[model samples]
Target: MSHAHPELRTPPALPEGGLRVIPLGGLGEIGRNMTVFEHAGKLLIVDCGVLFPEEHQPGVDVILPDFTSIRDRLDDVVAIVLTHGHEDHIGGVPYLLRERRDIPLVGSRLTLAFIDAKLKEHRIKPVAREVKEGDELSLGPFDCEFLAVNHSIPDALAVAIRTAAGLVLHTGDFKMDQFPLDKRITDLRGFARLGEEGVDLFLTDSTNAEVPGFTTSEGELTPAIDTVFRTAPKRVIVSSFASHVHRIQQVLDAAHLHGRKVAFVGRSMVRNMGIARDLGYLNVPKGLVVDMKVLEKLPADKIAVICTGSQGEPMAALSRMANRDHVIRIEEGDTVLLASSLIPGNENAIYRIINELTRWGANVVHKGNAKVHVSGHASAGELVYCYNIVKPRNVMPVHGEWRHLRSNGDLAVRTGVDPSRVILAEDGVVVDLVGGRAKITGKVPAGNVYVDGQTVGGATEGTLKDRRTLAEEGVITVVAIVDADTGQLAETPDFLARGFVSEEATFDAVVPLIEKALARAAEEGVGSAIQLEQLIARAVGSWANRTYRRSPMIIPVVIDA
Candidate 1:
């Protein structure tokens, strides 16, 4: 496919010999990993991704990066380079494609396939250029070299962008696994060669910088998974991230070896596996895989299920099964293995599900209980190794929380990189690399845009606050009909309370207090609907706080008769 976009022929307005590196997201945070490389007014975007919502962001579907910086500069964008196919790295492509469709997407074959599958769901046919390891592409003044890297998923890449100023290396999410499942180890030699050529700045993944030693390889988990398959008394159900094709491949291998038929149990699990298998990234034995319905008829000891919800997502398959609400039930002698890392904030929900599975007479195993999981990011030692190999003049830690970034920076200093050369930045901070030096230049618009239901960037903080208030304190709505001019009460006020009062007796008791307050407000000669609403709201709010020791959201609706 042609990777060139001849339509973007406008000459860029170059900065004074400096290349601007703007982190739109994925700095001092876990996900939504996007960065903008601007040189001579030409922009190249790296990894348009999204962040999953937290508990506090009630009703939000997903959180996307604020793209205000590039909204007006869509014409200047040359191409978008994807480091991997993980949702956190490519989830925001649909949103970006909506803004501009002509921008060429550059990534590995499988990465482009994953992106194509994702965009198909949005009914978008994107212009993608598939590039493998060692491929070079030049967009405007920026020349990029795609280098192979070992990550949880296949076809992960680290990008080295050569600008007029210097070469900037961005090590996407990677770990130094000497014996990777695919035998495609991270290209250390490539990094070393780039270092010898003199790299100006290095952006590295810091997700596991707090970890001390090297991260274990995907190959290491095979034996442990084999033991699970060999020892499990009945059905083996494994939970993992759907994007982890290597883990899924291991699971399939184990199942096939044990003569167990495999069945995928989650939406994303089935979809991603199908895509991977079709694209030859995942190997599946014929007739070894069966449909979900066929799984029900198979003997318990002869079936293995790979599913999502390793983090205990409420709507996920494993969570539903744990709650006894799924079509497939967890029975006695069944084993459920969580072959994934526990995300930091999801411990409570994950443990709750584990406890529920145990209560249902099923054996549950996880990273806390077994050696079935390993992190995909490099640790402190591996970060030290990369820093030594690249030997960049400046190091910027990306793709981590604050503590991880700080720890990664500290490791770089310990690796003989000068402390002055370590540049610490958060999202939206502009780091300019020029004259063989890197420094924070300025800031830009950076924050999360919440996706709620069908709306993107529609859920504001105020909307979330209202949802939280309604969830915690309930709502009390009072409807009153009054005279148009005089604001005199035409009838008695009607009160409706939801979640605040469960019993009719409690509601009846509160009605008299609300009535007395309304009567007093009418007697006080309220003149306007707004004035009466404020009066009744204050009265009802005070009564609820004093009498019930509660503060429900009091809403007053006045109608003119």
Candidate 2:
């Protein structure tokens, strides 16, 4: 546990001096984001989040930050700040706040509100403070101000964190939306003000840095959705991110124009609508917002259902509906609008759900067919424009793939930010600030912690590699009988297998071969508990490779030993 922020020039550990930016996640990959800003004796964290790995990850549900590096100095962590209401920005609030219950959570009104709900979901209400444009706060050694920014979600903010070295402007998931539903442009003037104030470090969004041109506006999605629903013959069902109030509003407005009463289907949809309605962010007619249970009885043409689970999440309403397991089913003429992009690693699941929905006689509309979803990240030109406006002394792109980060480093260099200050870091790398100059400092104990439904454990790079190999090679469980005296094996091994049967109907054939292979080992006997287990596991693995054409994860269980 040394340096924190991902620094490309980092040593294996921190240099033990100066200001350091330690990022726990959101460097090598996209989610489970945690970043540390340490200067003097004070520390600040930006956006603790978790990543939801693809299905190939046996039982993991959400992935969170590895807090080993900063756990001892938890009290030094003055604030856990938020950038937006997106899952990757706010999902880890409850988990982190549960441990550091006294720490203050700060963010914009909407962002804070969303975090409040998330914390409540875990039965934890964090101490909260609101962040808005033009408000400044000094906590310990950190001075902070918020700038309003436009993204897919409302009330997205970029933080200009002030330190003795200078300001670190963090562009929190922003895009230049000229005609947004909020109708607020990306706050370039705020960044310009920071530039005037002298920002020493700039941690900007790299999600779209590799993509050319400006990002598409949320407003552009209107006419496309308008056309699709207008021409549709039956009810329109839309699914997207819960924080995407703009998208939800678009669907609602389109439904309103088409003489349909919107029925919110998922828990998140209902909850977000309530939040939006309470805050005057969504203007739903009194009777338009019917609950899912009530909407189930309505005619196909009269009600439009908006839900979550556009990415084929099994628990999502769309997934359940596709499988005919939802309270309401899509009939032959119903239209299902997948109002979200397919996250990488979820393509197959999404397509499977879409195909299922199609087979169930419903029409599934994606990006090509309907004006459904658009990205909320800024493109290359916008990032360049932001750099020019901020004119920071240092630039380290945050958020996105490696290509995006590298592209941004090149872009900032081209925009006159100086190549020496361009820091490209992977996860856990730290950038140290010395004599007002920022450079790659070191590394830290930062990585993803694999979380099961109820169990949380640290996951290493090796875990993923093993999971991939096992997924491809299959698995074998060997049940062997061992004698308690002298820890000896007593009889032939019993075997079972699942994934790698060349003939699914004849999978039972695997057991005979494995039994014959391990019978010799058992006859030879085991000296110790470890020996028995290893012997059975090795025999099962060998038998699996020879007969099944692939190595199975050999699980050896000895009975009566």
Candidate 3:
């Protein structure tokens, strides 16, 4: 199998009748899924999404797929095709639409509804075209067919794109759940039909490719969740992704069966579940769901709460509850059910919340402890089955980390796919399908565009480095008054430190080093305040590193006396 090379250069012009695939994100990571397809000088985008910030990305809200390569070609974009409504698959829609407000969005009915509601909050009305399974739409030069696929969320789809170059099938996040709560299993029949018709290239979900066997069915979690609601002595708090309609449906059924009222917490959970109910995606037992205020009035044993932050996001509802900062406190004997799989890069944060909730006397139940959650992507066995059914001429693994991608490629090869035809790509790596062959041709500018508060792409690596320094080593400020005639110290340097040294006397040893550096600068006839400040900063930084084995941020102020 061929893998992407880090030394790739800018791709040459697309071959005649060729389809160019450029993945801006979701290649080597778990979220921020997006891909740009160019054929006949028009672009068809698939899955504009966002990546949640990790612990190292301080103060960042979300990360978007860098649109630098396609910024100048927004006019060529025919539509943004979303396969599902999961945040990683659709959260970046509003941001992308902000660039071109008139860009049409095509997806299933529930998927469009979810995105439309989100867009309303951004004050942007979308031009949406809703499609269902067995629906086909002609977008520019690409003829697209949407097929039903079962996932954690309702109305998931896998799209097959037909162009002059060949047919490319993109299986957006999906799993073959034989006993899904909604009875919507992934369409292996459709895959077989496409295989009979000849799939030139297949872009499959690789999120669970590293896992050995088939994923556990969602139905298995019903009994587990019901048990939690039945046995809990107090309020049962179930946390999950806001878009996980099926899981919430099971929660509602369990609550109804156990004679308890359910209340949705978190703005997103309320909005999304409300949409799901109105759209008939989520079955709400009448009188079983109540307002948070109404549920609070009842005895704790009769109430069940559903909220977000299954991943332990610091500002999310569950995290706040764990920190005792939310209205719904984790009291003694309360049962907390984390009803989602742990996302990559979130192990530490999730464990911290689990520990905190346990400390607060809540019995924390998670995937590691019980059959409370399952992945939304197909495992290796299912992937191999699909590979045999589809039997595409070329295979490309999308939406996973490097290990998952490599493992997926290996699975395809083991299923008789040509080793050379398996394309292993990361974000920014360009692949072209020409003459029914897909290969990495070059690279593009696919970097993380961080969203900090109201600003997008404003946070840089340097900013994050400084934030880490401040959080880890702290900052020290040095103020020295210098004479006007000579850049000599007029007063002993005063040191103020934060997150570095607590006591003032702790920095006493560095004062003499600063004085000596100032004297050397004076003898060298350095009269500029900027130069003096630089000298003092360098001297103090060296002393701190040498004496305390700490390299904190140093701010030197030299005042002309």
Best by lDDT: 3
Q: Give me the runs in candidate 2 sitting further than 4 Å from their true place.
A: 1-18, 458-475, 479-493, 499-526, 557-561
* Local accuracy of candidate 2 as per-residue lDDT tens digits, 420-457: 78888877877877666787756777756887667677
> lDDT scores for all predictions?
0.87, 0.79, 0.93
Better candidate by lDDT, 2 or 3:
3
- TM values, all candidates: 0.92, 0.90, 0.98
lDDT per residue, candidate 1, 1-561, as tens digits? 001122323223335878998888898789999999998879999999988877777898778889997799999999999999998999999999988888999999888988898899888899989999999999899999999999999999999999888999999999999999899999999999999999999999999999999998788888999999999999999999999999999999999999999999888888899999998989999998999899889889999999889888889999999999898799999999999998767788899999999998988988987889999999888999888888889988999988898998898888888888898888887778879888776677778898887898888999998888788888998898876755566776777888796554555555566556656766786567788788778878887888788888999998888
The model with the greatest TM-score is 3
- Cα lDDT, model 1, residue 27: 88
Where does candidate 1 have its weakest 10-residue lDDT segment? 1-10
Clashes of 3: 0
For each of the candidates, give the backbone clash count: 1, 10, 0
